[model samples]
Target chain A: MIEVKNLSKTFTSHVKEPGLKGSIKSLFSRELVTKDALKPVNLNIEQGEIVGLIGANGAGKTTLIKILAGIVHPTAGEAKILGYTPWERANEYRRQMALIMGQKNQVWWDLPALDSFILLKEIYQIPDAQYKYNIEFLAEILMVKDQLKTQVRKLSLGERMKIELMAALLHNPKVIFLDEPTIGLDISAQKAVRGFLRQYQKEFKPMTILTSHYMEDIKELCPRIVIIKSGEFVYDGSLSDVQKMMGDEKVLSVTTQNGVFKVSVPRQDLAKKTHELFEEHYVLDLNIQDPSIEDVIESIMKNGIGAT
Target chain B: MKWWKDVMGMELRKILAYRSDFWITFLGQTFIQLMVARALWQAIFETQGVSEMQGFTLEMMGLYYLIAPIGMKILNGPNFGFLAQEIYDGTFTRYLLYPLSVFQYKTLTYLTYSLFYSLQMIILLGIYRLFISEVAFTSVDVGHLFLGLLLFIIGAIAYCMMGMMIEMIALWADNIWSLAVMLRFFTSFFGGALIPITFLPVWAQNILVWTPFPYLLSLPIRTIMGLSTFQEVTQGALILMLWTLIFMEGVKLVWKKGQFKYTGVGI
Candidate 1:
């Protein structure tokens, strides 16, 4: 289980001036600027639930994940994963959780991926039989069993990412924080990751919070979605609810003799509007469809979530 | 204990994997430096018409240069620049997420490096004994040798702590390469890796005697050469231990504050 309340982070940086005179002046009178990466937010994730966290760049998605991962201390509020404060970085808390930053590697570059797993095995103090069983099971599920002996640097991006997942999951963490776990991979690799993650959720039922730029990943893996805007959560509900909240209007595409005409109308008024259109013109084809989740998220991002 | 052993083993494997760098740095560079140093000392002794300089015989000076590299290698271990680079690049997040302490992990990595360098030094020494007729530690004092080994271990740890503290400044500065170079220069000059501390002016020697740099490499070399009295060895050991404690405490404070300042940007 994961719980976050009023969790926020602000970064302060020095405002340095250019040129020698400005540099000299800054020594005595430097300006400091603060940027809020996360506004106060609250959330609760139940065990085995895969929560997709979506936001544009600088939307505090990664910041929130880092705080919960205990890699970055929050500026305000508290986050508890399995009842332990993350920032305390208690060993027991660490042992029960795993954080994977897709852009960065957790495996050793020069050594075989298996070597890194063995090192993790020791670090977590896992029993030999359990460790062996977990590695074999994870590798088989991820279809990276043979590639485990290859030097990590020599593996393809997809292969390396699979090994990274294995390395993180070797101890069978109770909670997993994944930040863009499929960021740079190709399509098949992305699908493979999503498949493995979905299966992992089904089998182990660990609480997982994932942030990814890929919309399809969210659509495929996350049944529940949390949409954040400008460091605050704008929407938190089922994926379908996001589509509905984007608006009750469904797009209507009518293929007339002249051309295809698209118009948006409220779902409740769709039948009447289509009937009137049919009366006024010759309709070759008519299609009514709700907006995609991607469209809903894009709308929320462009024109604050409240407008949706 | 298993974790520590595993960490050290992992580091050793990493070091061994980079065979080219290991051979070039440990064998090539050290061999060239030793040969050049021996030639320079040979020229000075042959031309000066003096048997000894600053209480060092030509043979002793030759042996000092030979052993000084090994001593400096042990004292400095590997540069902590990688630690600084890790902080700057955000790769350190890996350690942050792990259950193990980063300090202990890094210390073990450096210890493995030092151990590997010690092995290389032993091989070099064996080669020297095989090919050359010259005897290095002719007047071996077992008690002093034991004391010197203990001091050497403490001094190596003190240097590691010092390097880590310096590298932690990378959390604030973008380029710590210049700072690291400055540290190396200061340590090599005062630690007598460049020249015997006795060759310096008496006041300079007195000033350095109170600092930790000399104890890092110079005192250990002197103790092994049977040049230090029992009282001086005891005093140096205590001072080295004190310096180790101070640097370790500084590391804790600096690392704690540095983590707060960490932006985790590079990755």
Candidate 2:
């Protein structure tokens, strides 16, 4: 189980003005500014559960992940993962946890992925049987067995990401923190990664916290979602609960001979609105659907938690 | 021990990835420096019309120049900017996540490079002894050689810690490259890689002896060449060890404080 209480992170940086004159002046006297990257937030995640963190850029998603992963120190609050404080960086705790960042790679670029895996095996001290089995199983599932022998720098982005996933999962961590793991991949590659992750989670039953911009990833993999805005958690619940909180609204789209119209209406008024649109124009096609997860998230991001 | 061996193997593979590049750079730099030293020293000797200066004959000076570079190379180890660059780019996050000590890993990497250069030095020395005539030192004393090897290892480790100490400044400084370059220059000049310490004035030599620079290159070469006594090498070892301890402490303190400042994002 992961328990976080009043966790926060604040970054302080010096402000520099533009131009040579300002640069020289600031060297003698400068102003410092502080920004709260993460506010005091509380969260609890249980084993075998995958929680999706939804937020816009600079919304503290990554900061929260970094804090929990022990990569960054929190300004305030306490967090216990599997009964261990992460920032202390105990070996037993680190051994059972894995942090994978999509934008950054941990593999050595100049060497084959297998070489890096060997080094990791030594670092983690996995038994021969377990290490060999994991290597085979992860390679087969991710479908990058051939590419493992190639240099990481030589592999395509998709292949490299697969190798990275395999590397992170080699120890079969009990807790996984994935930060935009599918970013910058093609649609097919994205699907492949999602499929692999889903299977891995099912087999290992590790607690996973994933943050991504792709709604499909959340919709397909996560049963629970948390929305963060400006360094705070605005809403935390299942997708259906959030949709219901939007007050029984449905999106209506009508394509007529002249043009296509799309709008949102309350569920009770959906039928009347569709009929009125059909009567007003020569409708070739019409459809009524629930508001997209993307729309709901965008609205929540723009407004406060009560916007739903 | 097995883990260290595996890591060392990986480091070796990385070094061998571009064989031609490594060979060209290593050999080219060594020979070019030797050539320049040879030209300058020959001119000085000819103009002075003397067979010897500062207790070093022309042959001894040539041998000194040849061995000094290898000694310095062994001490310098691999690139020290690795940690600083990783900190600047936010890639240092990986080290935090790994269940191993970053300092230990870096020290091992440095040792691997130093060991490889030591091997080159050995092979070069053997070749020179076998092929060249008029070798300056005819006989090798096993005791002196052993002492020299010990001091070489200590000096290399000391230099590694010093490099890391400079690199930890990346936690606050925007750029550490200039500082690193400055360290390299100071080590080469003060350590007597550029010119023999014996050629310097007595006052300058006395001042440098108290510093860690001479143990890094000059003293080690002189010890191996059978010019320095066992007592002198022992004293130098003690001083280098003290310096290494200081650097180790500085690195630890910086790392402890720097963790709070790290945002895990590129600066």
Candidate 3:
């Protein structure tokens, strides 16, 4: 179990003006500004639960993950993961947790991924049988067994990400933090990664927190999600609860000779809107459906929970 | 211990990956330094119309030039910007998550490169002794040679610690390349890699002896050449050890403070 109370982080940066003249002037007198990356927030996650964190850019999703992963220190409050404080970074705590960042690689670029795996095995002190089993299993499931011997830098991005996932999961961690794990992959690669993660989570049941821009990943894997905006959590509940918050609104999408068009209407007006769309144009197809999770969440992001 | 061995093996593989680049840079730098020193010293000797200056004969000066570059290479080890560069690029976030000390891992990598450089120095010395037999320093005392090798290893470790101390400043500064370049320039100039300390004035030499610079390269070379007594060698070891401890403490303190300041951005 992981528990956080009033966890917050603030960052201080220098405010510098542009040009060489400002650079020389600021050397003598500088201005510093503080930005709150994470406001005081409370959260609790149970074992075997995967929580999807949704936010726009600079919305503090990464900061929250970094704090829990022990990569960044918190400015206030406390957190305990499996009875250990993360920032203390005890070996016992670190050994049972894994952090995988898509934009950063833990494996050495110049050497083959297998060499890095062997080094990690030593670092984590994994038993021989367990290490061998994990190597074969993760490689086979991720479908990069052949690429393991190639230098990591030479492999394609998708292949490299699979190898990185293998490296992070070599020890079978109990808590996993994934930050944009499928950020830059193609559709097929993304599906493969999502399939691998879903299967792994089913077998291991590790408490997982995933942050991604892909709504498909969230919809497929996460039953529960927490929405953050401006360094604060605005909503935390099951996906269905968020959808229900739309409150009697339905979507009417019509495909005509021109193109497909979608509009949101109240439940009472769904029939009239569908009839009006069919009469207005040569409708190839028309349907009344629930608002998509993406549209609903996008609305919530642009306009706060009060608007919902 | 097994972890260290495995990581060191990885470090060795990285160093060997670009074999041609490594050799060209290492051998090319050594050759250029030796040629420049020889040209300058020959001109000075010819202009003075003497076989000796500052208690060093022309042959002895040539030997000094030959051994100084190799000795300095061993002490300086490989480049020292790994930490700073990683920090700047936010690649250092992995080290924070790993179940290992960043300092220990970096030290192992640094020592691995130093060991490779030591091997090169040994091969070069062997070739010098076999091909050029008329040099006065050829018949070196075995005991002094062993002591010098020990001092070289300690000095290399100390230099690694010092480099890390400078790199830890990356938490606050945007670019630490200039600091690293300045360190290299000072090490080479004051550590007697460019000119022998014996050529310097007495007061300057005395002042440098108290600093860690001379002990890093000049003292070890002097000890290996059988110019320093056993007592002086022991004193140099003690001073180097003390400096190493000081640098180690500084690194620890800076790392502790820097962790809070590290944002791990850009990833």
Best by lDDT: 3
CAPRI-wise, candidate 1 is medium
- Cα lDDT for residue A259, candidate 2: 82
Instruction: Note the DockQ of each predicted structure.
Output: 0.70, 0.65, 0.80
- Model 1 chain B is weakest, by summed lDDT over 10 consecutive residues, at B133-142
TM-score of each: 0.91, 0.93, 0.94
Which pairs of residues clash in candidate 2, taking residues 3 or more apart in a chain or in different chains?
none
Quote the lDDT for A304 in model 3: 81
**What do the candidate models score in CA lDDT, each in turn?**
0.85, 0.86, 0.87
Q: Write the per-residue lDDT of candidate 1 for residues A1-308, one digit (tens) a residue.
A: 89999999999888988999989998799899999999999999998898999999889898898888888889999788999999888999999999887898889999999899889999998999989898878988899988988889999999999999999988888999888999899999999999999888888888999999999889998999998988999888898788777478887889999999777687889899999999999999999887777767887877876666
TM-scores, chain B, all models: 0.92, 0.93, 0.92
Candidate 1 RMSD to the correct structure? 3.6
State residue A274's C-alpha deviation in candidate 2, in Å. Answer: 7.8
| Cα lDDT of model 2 by residue, A140-241, tens digit | 988998998998999999999999898899999999999998999999999999999999999999999999999988998999999999999998889877
Q: What CAPRI grade goes to candidate 2?
A: medium
Colliding residue pairs in candidate 3: none
Q: Give me the displacement of residue B221 in model 3, in angstroms.
A: 1.3
lDDT winner between candidates 1 and 2? 2
Over 4 Å off in model 1, which ranges? A15-31, A252-288, B140-149
Q: lDDT of model 3 at residue A187?
A: 92
lDDT of 3 by residue, A1-308 (tens): 99999999999998889999889989998899999999998889999999999999999999999999998899998999999999999989999999998988889999999999999999999999999999999999999999999999999999999999999999999999999999999999999999999999999999999999999989989999999998999999999889998868988788888889888899999878778887889999888789888878987888988876
